[model samples]
Target: MDLLINHFWELTITGLAIGAVYALVALGYTMVYGVLRLINFAHSEVFMWGSFAAVWALMAVGAGKASGLGLAGYLVIGFVAAMTVSALIAMLLERVAYRPLRKRNSPPLIALISAIGASFALSELMGLRDKPLGWFNLENLRDYLGRPRENLPLPLQIQTKAVFPVFNYDVTNIDLIVLLSAIVMMVILDQFIRRSRLGRGIRAVAMDPEAAALMGINRDRVIRLTFLIGGIMAGAAAMMYLLKIGVTRYNAGFILGVKAFTAAVLGGIGNIRGALLGGFVLGVAENYGSALFGSQWKDVVAFLLLVVILLFRPTGLLGESLGKARA
Candidate 1:
């Protein structure tokens, strides 16, 4: 309690920044659930793949000593690389894992099993770096694949320079970049979903697949678009994760993915805006809990908060159905 009070502003700002990442990742989970009523567990790998893409892109450009406009250009390169890779992987996951099952009218349970299988396959593919290299005889790629199962660090180090002070806590450039970037992305997504023609198709399918199909909406295209959009969001979140944490592994997304799912459920599984609210709340609460108890207890605190909230309101904080989202 004392620790939290002493560093309230610091915790809050840091928590929000972390929460922004969670929120972006959570968006993927929420959107998939809204349309297909299935949990795409493999979405985590989409994030992990994006992280690697960013690192590789930065490395390719010799970002190790970049500064000024050059550094900014490299940042853009990383984001584009990550987003593109993540989006492609996401679409592939859908086409390979879920689409076939849907075509067969497979049960939701079967689709779930496929999701789990896809997740493991993707993770192991990254972990077994040598197999692919050996298959292709790509000796030069060994540097990038380094130690099959080890953590990969970013090529460039981001300095944490404080940009301002709030309540005696210095807010850094990273904090503003993370928080503002997340807000802008969220607003863009919300508006796109509410106003675009494709967005209406998504909502129509979420509300009633048969009716949507009858109305000339292509359910297949909507599903693909949903996965694409979710992938893009996950890709952006991957960049945010790299900026904040600076290290990643093949299985890195496992824990964070679970937390993001919790955020999705905490906000209402199928609600877009609910995900944003839930993520911020979870992040701040986790920080406070860490201060009061210990950093090790952070996960416990987050899940406990989720349990408590669900006990009272099973639907979630802003539990509006995606089909009925307000403009």
Candidate 2:
């Protein structure tokens, strides 16, 4: 308890940064689940690729220094690249893995299977890029994918220089950047879903597909848009993760994706605001639990919280359907 009280603000700032990542990733899961009622298990790859996209962007421009206008411009470049690539990949997944299944009116199980298969294929493809294509001298793959156990290097490192103090904790530039950027995204997304025309279409479809289709709302387009939005959010998260942790791998997204999925379920699967709420709460709780127990127990504490929450509030904290949500 003393450890917690003394380092409370430090832990809190850390949790919020991590929770922002989870929340961004969770938005992808929750939005898709909201409209399709099917979890896009392959969404992890979407996030992973986004992370790579940012790294690639920075690498292409050879970003190094962490401060000044040049670095800031490069950061924007990285984010834009990440979002573009992530959105494209997500759209690709929808077209290849999901579109055919949906057209065949396949069972939900089939879609789930397809998602898992796509995920594995993508992961292996990244992991083996050097293995399979190395014979062709196609640019050393070690620069990006490397061996399965090895992590890809991120050249740009955001120096965690303190800009302000939060009670006893010194808040850094990276902390504010991540938290504020995430909040901006969430606010925009919530407003879009609640007030925009296409967002209304999304809500309609989520509430009733047949009804939405009958009303001349193109279900296919809406579905694609949902995936795109989710992908974009995941891209934002990918950027933050790379900037904060400065390391990534082919399968990096798998665990984070699962945790984000749990955040979605914990907050009320189809609700946007619920995702935000669940992510922060879970992050804070996990940090506190780690303080109470030990650092190694943090992951255990997070998942355990999900189990406990589901046991008590089966529908989750907010429990509102996206269709009916005011966002």
Candidate 3:
């Protein structure tokens, strides 16, 4: 108890930082589910790819010795690479995996299977990218991936500095960046959806595809935009993750994706604001649970809470449909 009390703010801030990433990814899930009524399990890979893009961009830009404002410039390049790559892949996934199904009017199970297959295929490609390159004896790109599970060393190391007081603990640069950036991203999305014409079309389609089309809203365009927006957020999360954690692996997004998905469901799958609420709540819960149990059991605690939440509040704490989101 004394230990928990002593480190209260530490745990909370850590949870919030991690949770912000989860929220960014969770927004992808929530937005897709809202528009399509289907879970894009492969969306996790979108995040995984974003991380790689950022790291690869770092290598390409050679940002090793950058400091002060130069570090910030390099960070922007990495972020842009992540977002562009993620958005492209997400759009491709929608075109190949989901669009075909939608055109054929396939069952939801079929789409789910397609998503799973795409997820596995993307992950394996990231893992065994070298094998294919070796087939052509192309050694350059092979070296880029390094290894399947090895940590991809970060180039620009952004030092953490205490900036503000939060309770009895000092909030560091990392915490401030993660939290504020996440909040800003979510707010922009919320405003876009609530106030913009394109956003209105998205909501209309989420409400009813047939009627939306009859009302002159292009369903295809809306769906693509949804995927693009979600992908961009995932990319942002990837850059933020790299900044905060300072390393990544081929499959790093897998576990984090699961946590983010839980966050989506915990907040009400289709509700935008709910994703934010869920992510923070889960993060704090995981931290507190880890303090009580052990660090090794954090995953257990996260999933257990998900199960408990579902059992009690099936629609989530802030229950609302995407069409009627209380954002």
Candidate 4:
């Protein structure tokens, strides 16, 4: 019984950490889908870019070797830098790739194709870009964020080791930070959507663009805001992901994005709270499934759950009722 309890606690902590990352990434999907009803497949690349940006920033600050700043300060700086860069890139992508198609009254398929093309382009750019354009190297960004180890003076290290429990695993500092950051961000976003002027515009656009426009809402501006908000969320998620996993690659976002998208759908697409609920649920389910079956079957379990959910609850846990208001 003790052993089982220990295992359960370990899994719960792990699940929560992973779920937080999923929720961060999933928010981008839910927000974009809420307004445009288009899945921004390029969103994964936005996350990738954010990871790379943080890496470059650390290198520039000479913190690549983990030489400077307390842990909190390092994280704050890295997250802010990453968010800014990623948001800018996401905006550019929307303007260059998505907006043009939207303007032309192109079919949703066309927009999807554009998203795919843009995703590939960003990945290729990371592969080819000389001098490592962002703050950190893509290859090492994950490790830097996750472990963040530095060499301390031998005496200080020995003293610190003597004082602190070496293997205590209630929850990692990284895990706590990620969870808290995700909660704060989500709360702020929820309030923004419910209370702010732009928030109303966004809700209005999602509900009915024609009606929103008739009410003097600027559709283009609202659309841009949606992309920007999604991009910012992705950037934050990318930072958390790297911190948790400790490494990244140019194509890392592909699988993460797919899973997050699944989470969005699982919670009921276009529903804000649904995305949050779906991400955590999927994260716990995936971890538990892997523990029971094997890591290889994790994906199968995720899809199976989705299929089962769709079979019975076609509208998802929250249902399509959320979209009815907009409809």
Better of 1 and 3 by lDDT: 1
TM-score of 2: 0.96
Report the C-alpha displacement of residue 216, candidate 2, in angstroms: 1.0
All candidates' TM-scores? 0.97, 0.96, 0.95, 0.85
What candidate 1 gets wrong by more than 4 Å, as runs, is: none
Assess candidate 1 and give its TM-score to the true structure: 0.97
Name the regions of candidate 3 deviating beyond 4 angstroms: 140-142
| Per-model lDDT | 0.89, 0.88, 0.88, 0.75
What does the lDDT come to for candidate 4?
Answer: 0.75
Give the 10-residue window scoring lowest on summed lDDT in candidate 4: 151-160
Give the alpha carbon lDDT tens digit for every residue of 1-327 in model 2: 899999999999989888999999999999999999899999999999898888888888888876878778987998899899899999999999999999999999999999999999887776665765567776665565555556877778777789899998999888788898899999999999988999999999988899999999999999999999999999999998887888888889899988899889989999999999888887787888899899899988998988888989998988957887663
Q: What residue runs in model 4 are displaced by over 4 Å at the alpha carbon?
A: 1-6, 64-69, 131-169, 321-327
What pairs collide in candidate 3? none
Per-residue lDDT of candidate 3, residues 219-258 (tens digit) = 9999999999999999999988887888888788788889
lDDT for model 1, on a 0 to 1 scale? 0.89
Which one wins by TM-score: 1 or 2?
1
Off by over 4 Å in 2: 140-149
